[model samples]
Target: MKKSLPAIAPGLPLGLLLGLSTAAPRAFAQEAAAPALEAAASLNAGDTAWMLTSTMLVILMVIPGLALFYGGLVRSKNMLSVLAQVFTIFALITVLWAIYGFSLTFGGTGLFYGGFDKLFLAGITPDTLSATLGTIPEYVFVAFQSTFAAITVALIVGAFAERMKFSAVMIFSVLWFTLSYIPMAHMVWGGGLLAEDGALDFAGGTVVHINAAVAGLVGAIMVGKRIGFGKEAMPPHSLTLTMVGASLLWVGWFGFNAGSAGAANGIAGLAFINTILATGAATVAWLVAEGLHKGKASMLGAASGAVAGLVTITPAAGLVGPMGSIAMGVIAGPLCLWGVSGLKRLLKADDVCDVFGIHGVGGILGAILTGVFCAASLGGVEPEGFSMAAQVWVQCKSVLITVVWCAVASFLCFKVADLLVGLRVSEEDERRGLDIAVHGERAYVS
Candidate 1:
């Protein structure tokens, strides 16, 4: 039999075999490249317009909406400081996002950090399609995410309002946004650890709300109580303005939640309805709880409840059905009230605007409940292999990761700002208010 076998050609060398394996795919890829490019070129105009509008709405949230909301909550003496901080943070974060923030958050495929391949947006052209939402141009996605980054930083200003130096605020924002926000965004949205773990954060309960809340709490504690721990009146100067600001926030949130669907389609419409239902339900629940606790519900309670509802629904807007959204709102209203009252006292941090109380507590609740609600048994569009217990665990892990990272990074940022420019204004400046001392102008003249 051995003698009868025919002679055989020698097998190709190992290097040749490896090269053939790799080069064959590369050749096929080159052949198919034109079709991929053509597919990417077929951009949807409607999606582009919606994303652009969403970006504008989120910008409005930070500027007059958040600014006026926080401004009304502080004493009239410090009103200008709150407004100035919000406006300036928006401008600064926007610039940073264009330069390096977007690239670092969305460029690479690393677990904890992203690469600088798109540094200074060097490779992005008008024709380039987004990696995530391919129907829109990459530029529109950049602009949309920029607004989110701006609002996240702006939200933190509420916690340390009325006392920190403007210089300190500026410095702390840069550091925290760079260290805390970028990494969190990567983990949740940029194909990092959290995203890889199958953690579901539809619209950033962990990234936006919890991250900002923890940072705010840390800053408040580090800056110390605002001169008079528990002794002063410290009432909101204008609930009228507060109501208007809250109203603006509610309107703009439609874009914030629904627009996260990245298309002008059924999911976006569903998110829109959920946002409305949840916000309205939260408002009612807040009033009811207030009546039970204090015997009379104030307009302020309604406004705060609405905002809390908005926060609670942020993670679930596109994930859960209408009933689940309402349930979240109802749960969040009373829970957040307790957070502002009981948890606030327990922590003893001077979170001036209750940033941690409402946003933080509501965000956590929404995130965890989102996992439970997004089940086939609960009316959500569940996946084939969805497990409620598994998803809930993943959400908890995501929340824990965000809290620890933000807490530690923000503490370091505050320390650095303290070393560089100092954190708190003088006691005299605190009494006079940052509006006068820092800006050389008063919010209201007698």
Candidate 2:
């Protein structure tokens, strides 16, 4: 009678009205949450595109880029062998990554090793989004990380190049990739120990460069020297090809650095610019150092410097400022020069392509400097409550961990390979060169 009861509630009892009143807000909340849920599961097309491009670029870095670079540095007789090794390693690692490698790296919640929950890439689909990346499809992330693993294993080939048996190299690569690379990658990048400890390897200072370098060093020592290593002259067969490969590496490295951002955003832009500046600065610095030390600035020195700069900036690619990257580059050139020369001789290990020198020395230096340059005062995008000293200490500890882990694991891997297939070819085979001895191919027909 008061108002004949309003429209829809005309016959509803008091309790029913009360219940409906309460349910209204709950229904509204459910509706509101639906969009958010959809968004959370959605992929950013731009990010996916960039990551796809980045994966391709990194593949370029391995195949022709690293292959040619390493091939040019070896003697003419061994050129085809170097290319074969790099190419084969790339193929091998890519397949392995799709199998257990990806699962053992990014699938678990362990402190040292990721579990096998994702073995065979199970439970993943085109629609699956990365929990960490949030927006990109998990498949893209997997492909991107696979490139990193491939290149890392390929890098070790340069250390024992021209001497190691093909079968031995393959065995060592499989073992080291499973044991050394996977663990280090988990610790640094896959939310394991070092990452938990606030280690600042923005783009794989410890995970990729240092990890590969240490393994390469160990392989060099265990594989022993090439037959005529110390007493002979082993000039690069084609500096021109080396230069071309270096150039390609420089171009592809943008993917290596900026792609780590996982998005086509400001951080990616920062990393791209830093890659250019640091590499350019490092090249000049290397030329100057070479001119001072050897009385000549060589194309080889320039190429080496560029690589050094690239390696040094990798750990700090998005963390440091432009000027800070240049400083890192400048420091990297000379330090890596010494690493290849003084450090190489001191160790008495014949590292054919200076894998330890440029990648190792530069990675350590970049990782340490990343701590310093990451200060907001130094134009870096500082971490929350950042302390340069604390970060630097964390960086040093990470480096120490990587070095020890890689050394021991690499040694064991080499031993296993040696026991299984022998680490070296016969002296006569080595003298004849790996191209003809192992692969039965020639780089040049003439």
Candidate 3:
């Protein structure tokens, strides 16, 4: 019998040689694929510490800033009710974020929502590093983002304040956070589809501001007009409370715009300066509009102007120079004032506290202006192939997408909540106000 040897495949020798030849390159590539957990060059340890502090500062914005902002805008009878709504919602968002919101917003590998591997914060520990944060603790990043979620939900209350049922508000908030907010957040920030397309949001123009504004508008409509709306003379019960809240928001906003840089660097510094200038310019611009149109600037107008400035500068804060921020502020002030006053009347939407006016309009303006003002010379990171016009078109696309997504989600949420638990307070609750009717507590004991 002939000695038979298993014949080697024709390509086996070549494959073996090729595999051996490429092994080192593959190993090298593997070694290179691991990301550094820290920055290439960290400057001041103090700077990092300050950023951590600022992150906490922003937490104050929604927990109290937004709570009191909406609280003081409603009637005195509904004051505590609104306050209750804000407080409870803040706590709810905090818990939900710990459970799933953070994962949904920041989890890996999804177009509209994040993955669930990090659900309930599993595997996240004191040492877990944030890939985007570069050595910053993942816990720190989560805490910072939690505040944004809290505020975004709180902002919607302004649209249906004093009229919405407490139970309904609670239910809808939890639902909408899961359904609308988290998905949009993933799309915008969490390495999702929009980010892959090179959209520059810097902060949360579409995610937070526009998201809340659109939801608020839809809730206002679906819940239907308040009993005395349009034909009534409803005024903010306490301008003093509104002023305090606005002031806190102004102070806390430093953290918001700057901390968005995710590092304590030159860009953060520039963002800080722009936030201040833009807010001041907008306040003055608002007063001017009120004086010219109404013969006197209202305190409410001033507060709204401050908010508008904050909203307008959010997207461009890291991208625009101080001058660009000031320009945006000047424009946002009057334009928002007009929208809040006469524009609501023209549209007849009964947006209770001008959510669409301040946030929606401001978000749009800031997003578009970001395209014009983003320059490498102005603390901006210019992406490859991104031009001003291209960026503007991209921003518009983002706005339109946000509007449609938010509109549908909000409408559906409101409708469902309405049918299940009812969106509006009873008519008796409306005339007597929600504090006594809904919460069964009077804001004033005296």
Candidate 4:
């Protein structure tokens, strides 16, 4: 807990270098200089308070929310190892972001990445406001985005849990965050190639979910299969705990999607409602698919499907209409279920928690659908451009770039970490389980 707090609440001193103002909308003129907003989005007291709360909510998703979720899924003997990896990775990502990740992604610069104006948060102050959120201090904005960054790296643990070495996880966490995650965030959200071509990623479908997904698949392959893949049972140790954690993730995602709008307003409200509607629809679709695929529907399938829906809607939450969100939920559920149970088995990849199936697959689906449903006519927002053909092209390009980049970069990082500390534990350690071998602790005791 001590290690984690410093990362989320690092007391970056709020000196007088920067000032708080409203987040004014930057006007985008095709092939022209960026138009300065006449007035940035104002920082209302209500907005600031809500954002602060939402920011903390996202942070919670990593600390206890994700830790508990993944911990409960693995065997009791390996729980703390998974938990420690999640906890430690959160802290490491926080420090790196405080140091350089934020600047490289959000600092103003040319295509591909940004310049180093905000190194170590050099000029950030309590008063400095980012153009995106108006008057809230830029430091505050960075703090909120930090949670997203932390959780993305932590999620990779699911792919290689129960086998990976803790020290190796630490090394890859930093490298992937800098080389891969920062560049993708810059391109899709911070004003890179995707944004230049008018791609729509309200939060981080490409930046977070898809990037994590591809990296996860690579890790699963590199770490190789679990000790007894098809031969062993390998069932979730506690479905009850998994369900509880999934519930928290469901509730916490409201902050994840709505907060992306950057303030308390109509757009936030729309995102919140769509989050609920789409998640509900996906839950239904997923359970239905599971019933048809297997002899009976499983509780885990229902929860996992809801997550798939949430991932699919994340990128389009702000731009797409409500009905479009519902449609996305309906489609992504069955697709994700098929990917997890069918394709995963055929491929024989050991993605313990289906990270690529749900997050990566769902994110790609969401990115493309954002173009389809973002029509002013669909998602409650006034549509800017709803060319199915054009937006789909943009969506395809963005997903392709994110997948390829994340895969290649993550593969190299994983290999380097492996060669350094070794990615997986020894055969003796595997038999003993990672909870004891890697972390020297257990999740519970009699």
How many residue-pair clashes does candidate 1 contain?
0
List model 3 lDDT by residue over 305-346, tens digit each: 999999999977766778888999999999988778777777
User: Candidate 1 residues 306-377, lDDT tens each?
Assistant: 999999998778778888888889998999988889999999999999999999999999989988886756
* Best-performing candidate as measured by lDDT: 2
**Regions of model 1 farther than 4 Å from truth:** 1-41
Location of the lowest summed lDDT over 10 successive residues in candidate 1 = 1-10
TM-score of each: 0.91, 0.91, 0.89, 0.91
Candidate 4 wrong stretches, greater than 4 Å: 1-36, 379-385
RMSD to native, candidate 3: 11.8
Score residue 412 of candidate 1 by CA lDDT. Answer: 100
Candidate 3: worst 10 consecutive residues by lDDT? 3-12
* Worst 10 contiguous positions by lDDT, candidate 4: 15-24
Error of 1 at 436 (Å): 0.6
The count of residue-pair clashes in candidate 2 stands at: 0
